[model samples]
Target: MVRHWWLILIACWSFSLSADEVTDLYESRIEVATQSRDDRQDALREAFSSVLIKVSGQRDVLERPEVSRQLSQATNYLVQYSYVTERQQLYLRAQFDEQRIEELLRRANASYWSARRPNIIFWIAQETQRGARLIGRDADSEIVPAMRRQAHQRGLPISFPLLDLTDLSNLSASDVWGRFERPVQEASRRYPSDGLVMVRVQEGDNGQGYLAQWTLIVGNTRRSGQVDTEDLNGIGMAVVDSVTDRVAAEYAVSYSETEASEFTIRIINLQDLESVLLVESLLRRLASVEQATLARYHQGTAEFRLQLIGDMRRALQALELDNRMQRVEDPWSVTASPVLEYRWLR
Candidate 1:
């Protein structure tokens, strides 16, 4: 995968994908064939490998010296495993220790891409025997399923344009194929997304393979790449690798939270004691927050004193990844300086 490390310094103003939707990301479970004992071992390694990639936002993280040394003991991390028979085949489902994985990453200083990832809207153009067409939200095209499978493997979340009246009116297949920035970016603004990805696919020389070209846009930063494969499936996998590598590089920050400073934080939208306690638990769990003590709660707003190991940036990244709470975009206050505030996303 091609990469250009760009440490993200700011959070998106708005996020479409919520925290509850991503809570299950740490649990890696894959179906394993029961054909042989070796298959079980291989499956365990594969599942752990997936966990490593998703957790670290580094495709080659499993190959890291410390991480690679543990693969032989892949099953050692497996918290539980089970066998289920379905349609003449037995499937093995495995669960690994989430805390152990996080501890390993922190020790390695790996770029931990929180499960609360950016929402990417894909505008893919495909060339067929008859013509070039845009893949839409309702598309049953080959690239859609292939991309979905690859995305699932990478634990990357992606969405397609609706191609409805609005999308078609604002942008077209030619716009994406031609890489028209203003129109494509404008079209993507309709979604609750942080970035825009455009993909163009065409048939290569007969019997050779297919060619897939792609570009990703996150604010002012943009990156593009291409892949040549025998079929669309291979191309889709390549697309996932390319996109995740770039996104991970930008957002999968390597800096771990540290405890050094203390600050008072204000939270809004806490409806009850449950919400207050939930936010408190979330804050205290972060490695950055050395201590989080509730200050007070009045009129649906809550306050806390946080002793942080690091700055708010890393802590925000981790908390945002969980999707339970997010920084307030615009805090309406009468004073010139307002307290640091986050909105509950639940």
Candidate 2:
């Protein structure tokens, strides 16, 4: 009879301890999840207007529709608390403002329009019997240089070669047709270019300057547009900009230009044998420097070398100035170990 009484007392003590632990857990949960009055009111407004809080994990705790509605309504006023299992911590935060979020979405849409690539090629026309004058013009006159410059400014990639119309100047109309056709047909080639721009310069209405007409042809399907101007520089720049904007819009890429300043360096220790290789290596590494080459290497008791390049400012910044060797004044000291001097390439 005494043993039975002892067993009953032990069981009652165990029950009381378990009940206390459960109550403590419930109180802690309530304390962590409760929110402020203002936050709850804001959350309620959002909840009433068709917005819903999406909680993925542990959603069974608030499964009832009424519970969810109440939670959403009080979310703004109620402190939002999240328990991160990995971190083992609770985060209390406020809800996002709908007005601010809507503005962000609108700006994102605008960015889509600005981030487009252009797909047009441009050419310039000059008077010539067989169009030899066109061929005589430099490669820089072709769409490649102007387009590359524009693309660089707009922060676009050069996806393909910029073809020059000068190459077609020597050909007859039939030759021109065949030249364009053979390569185009041989491999079933798709002209990586989206459109071709032809700029024709003729005597102006005033006869003082040239009258420029810009024509754009969109592939073989042939959708064309034209613009005319009296100032060649203005017309050229305007046509390129307009065509770039249109093509960029079509391709969906943003355009912007970064202007790179020129830097010059002179090397005073290059021999004829080492000149080519050394200059080539230097040029390859210093891409930001517009041009770099061995200008002259004189041999006596000591050797003297000269190198001219662009972008000295960046070079100094990159090299930290302290490590690079110094310039030589005495021609005699040059003969002993070969002196190198750096100068800006004009």
Global fold similarity of model 2 (TM-score): 0.30
Per-residue C-alpha lDDT of model 1 across residues 1-346, encoded as one tens digit per residue: 1111111211112224452234555556567656478988987888788878877877878767788888778887888877777787777667788878877887766656656577777899898767678998779877788877777667777888889999889977889998888999999888877788899998888658999889999645699999888988888788888998887776665645433677888899999766776677666656456678777788889988887655666566556655457777655665754468888877
lDDT of 2: 0.35
TM-score of 1: 0.76
lDDT of each: 0.75, 0.35
lDDT of 1 at 277: 64
Candidate 2: misplaced stretches above 4 Å?
1-105, 108-119, 128-148, 155-166, 169-194, 218-223, 228-230, 253-346
10 residues in a row with least lDDT, candidate 2: 19-28
Candidate 1 achieves a global lDDT of 0.75
Please report, as a residue range, the 10-residue window in candidate 1 with the lowest summed lDDT. Answer: 1-10
Q: Which parts of model 1 are misplaced by more than 4 Å? A: 1-20, 29-35, 85-90, 128-131, 189-192, 204-207, 219-221, 253-264, 269-275, 281-301, 305-311, 314-339, 342-346
Which candidate wins on lDDT? 1
Q: Residue-wise lDDT of candidate 2 within 1-346, one digit each (tens)?
A: 6436533543343211111011211111211223565544543444322211111101132433443444444433333333222254332323434333223323332211211122443444543355423211244444345445544433333333223453443333332222343432322223344345554545555565545444444433233344555555545544555554444333321112134444334454444433434333434333133344333344511222223233233343222211223444566764644333443121
Model 2 residue 153 distance off true place after TM-score fit, in angstroms: 2.8
